[model samples]
Target chain A: MSRIVLEGISKIFGSKQVEGVELIRQGKRKAEIAAACGAVVGLCDISFDIVEGEILTLMGLSGSGKSTLLRCMNRLVEPSCGRIMVGDVDVTRLGRKDLLAFRQKTFGMVFQHFALLPNRTILSNVGFGLELKNVPAARWNEAAMQAIELVGLKGWEAKYPHELSGGMQQRAGLARALAADAEVLLMDEAFSALDPLIRRDMQSELRDLQQKLKKTIVFVSHDLDEAVALGGRIVLMKDGEVVQIGQPEEIVARPATEYVARFVEHIDRAAVMRAGQVADRSAPVLQPTLTVAEARIRIAGEGGDAWLVADDDRRFVGCLLAARLAAARPSETVASLLEASGEAVAAESRLDALLARVAAEGCVAVVDPDGRLIGGVGSRDVVRALAAHSAESQAGDHPETSILQQTAGAERWTGASRNFPSTRSATKASTGSPTMALG
Target chain B: MLTTALVAVPPWVFIGLAALATYRIGGRKIGLLTLFGLLFLWNLRLWQATVETLVLVSLSTITALVIGIPVGIWFALSRRAWRTFSPILDMMQTLPSFVYLIPALPFFGLGAVSACFATIVFSVPPVIRLTALGIRNVPTELVEASDAFGGSTTQKLFKVQLPLALPTIMAGVNQTMMLALSMVVIAAMIGAGGLGRAVWQSIQRLEAGAGFEAGIGIVILAVILDRSTQALAARARPHGAA
Candidate 1:
């Protein structure tokens, strides 16, 4: 029920919205729409779901409308045309009173500047949302204390906002949102104001807090590395439109637009690329049942220190060193001479974590969640994955079609767009899947 | 009736209350000023007239604030309202202060009523202008935070805007009080009796010493009022406390 689905959300900012909205519906870009209607285009035909209990990053450069899109979810910035469905409720259709009540029950928001009330003590600031909800003072205070302790600011509750450092003030801001206990947390660049070191601390602590809390969080950021550190799907926006939406690794691996590719070009590829994604599928795998002579014949020309041996079912059996295979008598089975197994790294593990093993062993098996042998990630493959920071642009992809298809329940007719062969094939892997999962 | 009830109370009681209030809110120095300023006025035999002026200013400042603040808030919230009201406020400020008395005399005949009416008209613009300015000056992100949390309009005003705007509103209140005091002599042109009447009578009789004494009495009262309100506004700010 926490799934927030935005369908064809478009926001045009200015009194000339009727003309701007019509121009947008006619497939006008932001600049052209502004030129034609004299209204700044805020968001254009955005459709996506904020998956429950996961941090979905709205990532883009400044002025890309990521913050505006986040605000639209709670109707803080109303969309000119669209339907916003939060759980079963249509947030766009709700009246003023109903929307206020529903927002109180559903969303807790944090800001980039740590918007703590300067007049109130930390306890009162943390309990502000509850106070707005008309919660009893004693109850709100107790609940606020719990949130303050959760954020590690228990002893600082009596202090004013200005007395605390920037980092501590942000912790109090996060505690304020948590005290509301709403299901979704909308954090708009919540750490952008802090100095770099403190910003890093807040990012990791927010990730840890999200793990313990399990609240659905929609975080807006212009930093690619911060989005990757959050370990969630990225909805990369551009010029008031969603350019691409995928996991950090997937966006880095196969960016859907030239702008997105450029934005992610400088991101640390080793940290963003996953083990399964970087695995060398071209590596020859020998079966454990194969005779030693048969294995030698199968691996005659392939030059490597070891070969990953798997059973017939593709479950990884063990690594068979080249020396052992060469020294073995023709009568010995491949399984009898194999090294210990269970050395496979999970598919979801980032490539950086697998680098040490790959460098030490010269070969490491990458397995799926089921422990099935996917492929091996070797030193060369790791280097290739890191160096290949996707300079190739996804220029001809129909991003709008792919995004609509990816986020289902947007049954509106988007017309026939079969010309984009790359988009059609690229979207096929996650078609109808609930989320744009991490690779 | 209310003015008589207030005046019949012993002057020492008012003096003591003012001292305690200033001490608690404005600290020791302003508190001592309050005690001695009243004593000095009593020693000059100007205590009764000073009390009458204090009552008139208090009544008018409250009346002006009650009317001005809501109008300011409405103007700030609506661009069209601001567009319409901004010019009127400009006119109000630029118009001769004596013009307000011209209208007040026709509506409310001589004595305290006309004096109170003229002072209210003269003092209300700053309250309205500063109230709107304070609210508008609230940071955008803070307002957005409140809106995102689903705060009702009333809740946002009281909890966020009003509390943050306290210092600015207090400055406006101080200005209103000062403006009210400046009107005292002019208000004495009518039948209103107070420190203003003392100064005006001394001027008519050509008694320069009496006029100077009454003028010093008003100045002492002004200092006491300004320092106390300023301290009250300062205490409301937690940021400065740090």
Candidate 2:
């Protein structure tokens, strides 16, 4: 179930809020609405579902209403008109008192600049929400310590905010949210203030923490790299409207608009795309039950030093070496003649991870967690994928052509990757490797 | 009732306590200087006038704080309230010191009470202005943080805003006390009994020696109150782990 759902949420910030919202109903964009009424459109009919236990990023340039949308989730910035449903309760309909209690109970937020009480120690800051709720010190302290430990700040709890590093302070901010045990976290550029190396560390740690804690998080950021590193479904916003909402891979492969195309244009694809996404799913396979003579005849034209052998259910058996198959008896099954010579990589592995194995062994078998064969990645496929990306990027003169292919090639390519610029050599090399072996 | 009891206390007793509080908060050096200075006032037989001056300054400072701080907080929190009253506060501060006595003498009729009343009116502006400034200048982001975390208005005032603003507000209190002390000699013109009267009578008789002695008395009292309250402000900072 969706933990939070925002529907037709529009916020117009001016004395003419009525006219601004009416203009929105008449299907006017931000600039038109502003021109018609002296109102600034903070948000424009935004609708999106925030899945439970998922980290959804709201990304945009400054003033694109990403922060405004996040605050509206808890009514921190009251939307002009909308239905915000958190479970069964419609948050927009809540009175001030109920909204405060609901916000205290459900949402924990961290700001771009760590908004810690300067007078308070890290421990006290972590326990602040509990203190406001009148939770006894004994209980709050225990919860606070657990959260402090979770964020890897054990001995430093007694230090004031000024005493800690920016990263440490943000950890305390995170711990404060966790101590309240709130189910939803709204973090607005939580690590944007940190140095780059520390930002990366925090991003990875937060990703790990989310996996363990499973709190629904709506993170607002302008950095595409941060969104990619967060590994969540991203909601790309521009001019106070959602341009596209999808997983990083989907957005990269098919940007819904030019804005989205430019947004993901610089993303490191190898970091985001999995081997399953780039695998040659249509490659032919051999059943382990097939006889060596039958396999040789069945693969007469498909010349190769090795062949992937799988069972009837497509579960990976092993690779069949060409020499071993040729030397085997005509009645011998391919399973018996199979040699465990090649690497088997999980389908979810990244292409950067597969580069070395593909360089070492001419081909690697891609399998599911159940050891079922999905497809194979040959040196040719790797070069072809990389070449297509390089060619698209180099063809940057045509934005349309680049948008059609958003994948980024790896920076490092070896001798094996350089040889196969085309499928003809790729097919020829498969036979050539074995002939070289025999010679 | 508290001010009457404070006034009734022997001069030595009040001096001792003030010395102790200052020593505890301001450190031992200022404490020792205060003890020596008060003993010097007694040695010069100016103890009675010093006591009267102390009573006046103490009563007026307390009254100003009680009335000023809350009004200041109200002004800080409400923009319209501040906008309405800021000019009145400006007039209260800048009008002639004698203008205060014009109202005070007609209402209370020339006595120490009248002098004390005039001193309260004369000294309250700093505390109110600075207190409002202190609260108003507290970082808006911190206030926003407090609201986002569901802190109530009262809770935000006491727990977040006031504590952060204490240093500035205390500086205001110090200014108010200093103004009250300086008002004592002038207040003697309205028949108040204090070192101001000593200075005034000596001035009338053309006895520079007696006037200078009483003038020294006012200086001693000023140093004692000023250092003590300044120290109190310093101590207001909550101690935390190093």
Candidate 3:
């Protein structure tokens, strides 16, 4: 179910007046001075749904209205037009009292600046949100302490924001959001200000937290990599409008427009595509009585150099020797070559895992439910997939899936393991598929 | 020299104590520098006179701060009141100290009260400015964060703004106190006892030794007060101590 929804939202500023009007000459249009400031369409016709217990990312360059859209979600900056629904409530139409209550109970936000009170200790800062909500002092502190511990800042509660490093301060900000216990978390460039190493660590930590807490999150970022890594779906924005929205792989494979294509142009595709995308499904199956020479011919005909020797029940017994296929006699199963083997990966495994497996095994094979070889993939294929995904992602031809989808798909591929061969030529031919490769 | 010692010792003792307290609050460098300044005053033979000057300055500074901080906080909290009083504050800051004596002498009859009144007026600006600046500079994001969490205006001000503003406010207090000290010495011209009186007496007799002794004493007191207050300010900061 969608936990939050924004429909046909638009924000226009200074809509009425042109430039170079003197205040006296402008007269009462001066009272409409806001209208004279020139129209800035901060967000135009933006619409999306954030599913319950999912991480949705808004991705855009600076001035693209990603942050503005996030702000409008909570009425931090009121939208000129739109209906924003948090559950059954039309948040855009909320009165001041209702808005305040909604902000306290329904949403929590984290900013890029860490937004911690410089004067307060880490504990106090963390508890600040709860305190505002009128939680009793005792209860607030307890909740704050738990949040601090969650962020790995157990012993540093008494320290002030200035005493901590930038990363620690951001953690405190996260703790503050956690303490609030709101249903939805809104993060605006929260990790963008951190050093690269710290940002990566925080991203993993946030993922772990999300796994455990299952809170709905809407994160905003300009970096495509970040969005792909942490978001379940991505909404790409440009010049106050949504350019595309989709799973990371879909976007990478087929960007919605040229603008999106430019954004994804530099991304590595291998990191974004699943092993299933490039895995060959036509590996040869060996019979129990097949000779090594016969097996070799069968394997070659199937476009594979290896054959799986499985028993009648389809239990993977061993691999077949292609060179000795002709000498093998009947009743002599290929299971003789079934020495201890490395682990096989599912076809759906992400490219990152696939790469790791290839690195560990020098080659990886994709296997089905019965342990039958579906395809083989190597390091080179992973790289190729990444490149192809990036090229397609920039084109922005695919708009069905939001940017959140692309991010989530990218993350899955980068984190899972699978087997496939390096099909550079095939990848080139499939220019439409987006590759999200982590370089 | 003996008379100089008598006058200088009391103020130096208090000044040293204040400096030490400030050092404990601020840091060691300020403490050491304050001690060095006291030593320089002793070398000038004005340590005793300076000590006497310190007592009046301290009293006046305390009085000003007591009145100034609350007023500053009130002004910060209320736009209407601040607008009403802003011009008054401006006038107070711009008015000459000597002008205060014309009215103060007749009302208070030329004594410690008169001197203190003049010193208070002179020292109020730093306290007010610092307090306002500190509160204003408190991060808007933090304020918003607190509000989002459910904090009331009182909680936001006390928990977020005031505490953060302490360091800057303390700095203002330090400046005010220093300014007060200088004013107290000037106030001594109007029968305000202390180092300023001693300097005045020596000048009347054309006794360079007595004047120098009193001047040195005042310098020592200044060093002690300055260091200690700075130390206190530093120590009160959220980052350094906690």
Candidate 4:
């Protein structure tokens, strides 16, 4: 299902390409290689597969080679050594003429500065790629007009790029890329030039468009927030190398390197972490069929104010509170004692939104899409979720208060923030019971 | 050829057409200036000499543009070519115009052909230099955008770089035209007859008054051509731009 696969890609920008590449293979770092042969290392042994119909962001600050890596996908910046495979074709091996034709058909690109041609009208600029393919004028214009309308520039088709405002110019740039109907979109800092408010709007709109169009996108960005806002797997890079690649939450939760941990240190943990990530999947659960006599014995080993109950099929039935169980008749079915307050938070719900619910209910059932009970999130779980971050360790004596202070005005973090389906922290020691103890 | 054909059109008709052309291109002020300017030339009996000079300048400029533009494009797109060919341009510009004329006299003989050959050699450098500058000055990001969408080299030139460079290229054309006009008097020494010939003949007879009259006629023509081309370049700028 991968649209593009890049393997052993290393680009050395200098006249001494062969020597620089050999140095790279021999494990010389960027500065060493550059000093030895006067070659600037642009990318060093980059390998990743772009999944079909997903946005993958290449993120790093300036000089990280993120932009160079994006350009290398379509061969705008050719790698000194690499194998590039796009849908079964070896893109690097293609002849010059064939590469041009393939590039024409396979990729639609947008630029950071809205690089629309100054002389052409929006309509003409949008249709430039089609014109290159010798697509007939009437057909290309129709396609272009459709794209213009799609990007909400319907009435401004006749205006030149200079006539449009910065945001509008960016929309026209997006329209131009969309008009090509190319299978993959490689956007290089496409919206970094826009103001923050407009950038957020463009990010959400692009996310929506990508879903609707189902085009695979590889977006390059220097901003971590932008990468998070785009809601894709982030490829964190530094010094011409990938430091880590994962969903935003996974990255924030478990950074592979000190560098990566530093990058995620300032990120709002509550805003990025999902309920599933904080869910106590190892917690013991009682079956609804169990009587009060049977549930009491089962709950003896587990320490909780309440226990989530599920049917045999693992469908979430409800939770049995200790107070409710204490008042129940011995022979009564556990199902009859199930509390009305029990509500399951979906596994995909952001942890920030469920803070009050978990506080009010003591605990809540975390369920999968089909209402299958996966685990539980309690007051402890919410506090633990917030406390697990590296930031908390730096918070000293009042870490909890410092973390809570951010939630007071965290409205900005809630802007169409996409959540990565958080993974269960199975590696942590069981605070409840062994896995699948849902008996 | 065009100068010879205009000889039969009569002075009044030529004046009327030129006035109309300036009016269409530069508006009322320039139209009026052309009207009075040519009338003054007629009154001075320098009209015939003026026409010959206009035709010669026009021919030399057109030829320089036709030959220089592609070379300029080649230089802009390839640095290796620019490095190799730029010295030739520098030499062409610095070499005394008469030095080339001495070498050219054998090939073109004398009269208008020799004059035209010298005028072109002296004038082509500006167009070539400016055309290369115009094309090269197109923002790198814009060119990258075109290439990102898979524009071929020729497609990028005609569609993106060429249109953006038009205003600059037109300015080059104006420079070439100006250079061509300045070469006319020098060309007169080779037997090409025009306002230049009048100036030359006046110089030979020590007639300072007639030489000044011919010089004034050339000045008027320079102003007219300069203003006309400036108007054209302004119009060539991309629409909706200030």
Best prediction by DockQ? 4
Estimate, for each residue in A1-439, the C-alpha lDDT of model 2 and write its tens digit. 3389777788888788888877777678899987776799988887767889999999999999999999898887889986799988888998888887887788888888888888899999899877777789999999999999999999999989988999999999989888888889999889899999999999999999999999999999999989988988888888888777777766665556666766777777776666665665555678988887788787787644567777898888777766677888999888787666776788667677888876665567888778888777766667665565556557565645664444433312221122222112111211122112110
User: Which rank order by DockQ, best down to worst?
Assistant: 4, 1, 2, 3
Model 3 interface CAPRI class: acceptable
DockQ of each: 0.60, 0.41, 0.35, 0.64
* Tens-digit lDDT track of model 1 for A88-144: 998888999999998889999999999998988999999999999999999999999
Per-prediction TM-score of chain B?
0.95, 0.93, 0.81, 0.96
Report fnat, model 4.
Answer: 0.69
Clashes of each: 0, 0, 83, 0
The all-Cα superposition gives candidate 1 an RMSD in Å to the true structure of 6.5
Best by TM-score: 1
Candidate 4: give the clashing pairs: none
Q: Compared with the true structure, what per-residue lDDT tens digits does model 3 show for residues A1-439?
A: 3388776666665543233122212222222443545445566555666779988889999988888898888877777765788899988777777788888888889998998876578998898788777789999999999999999999999987888999999999999999999989999899999999999899889999999999998999988888777847778887677777666766665556667767877765555666766553444556655655555566664432344555565445544433444456644545555435745677656667677656655446666766766555655455545544553455355533433345443433433332332212212221212221100
Sort candidate 4 into its docking category.
Answer: medium
Computed on alpha carbons, the lDDT of every model, listed in order, comes to: 0.82, 0.80, 0.70, 0.83
**Candidate 3 wrong stretches, greater than 4 Å:** A8-37, A75-81, A92-101, A117-121, A131-141, A154-169, A280-302, A306-348, A356-439, B1-59, B70-95, B102-114, B185-213, B240-242
Model 1, which residues run further than 4 Å from truth? A286-313, A317-342, A390-439, B1-8, B240-242
Error of 2 at A180 (Å): 0.8
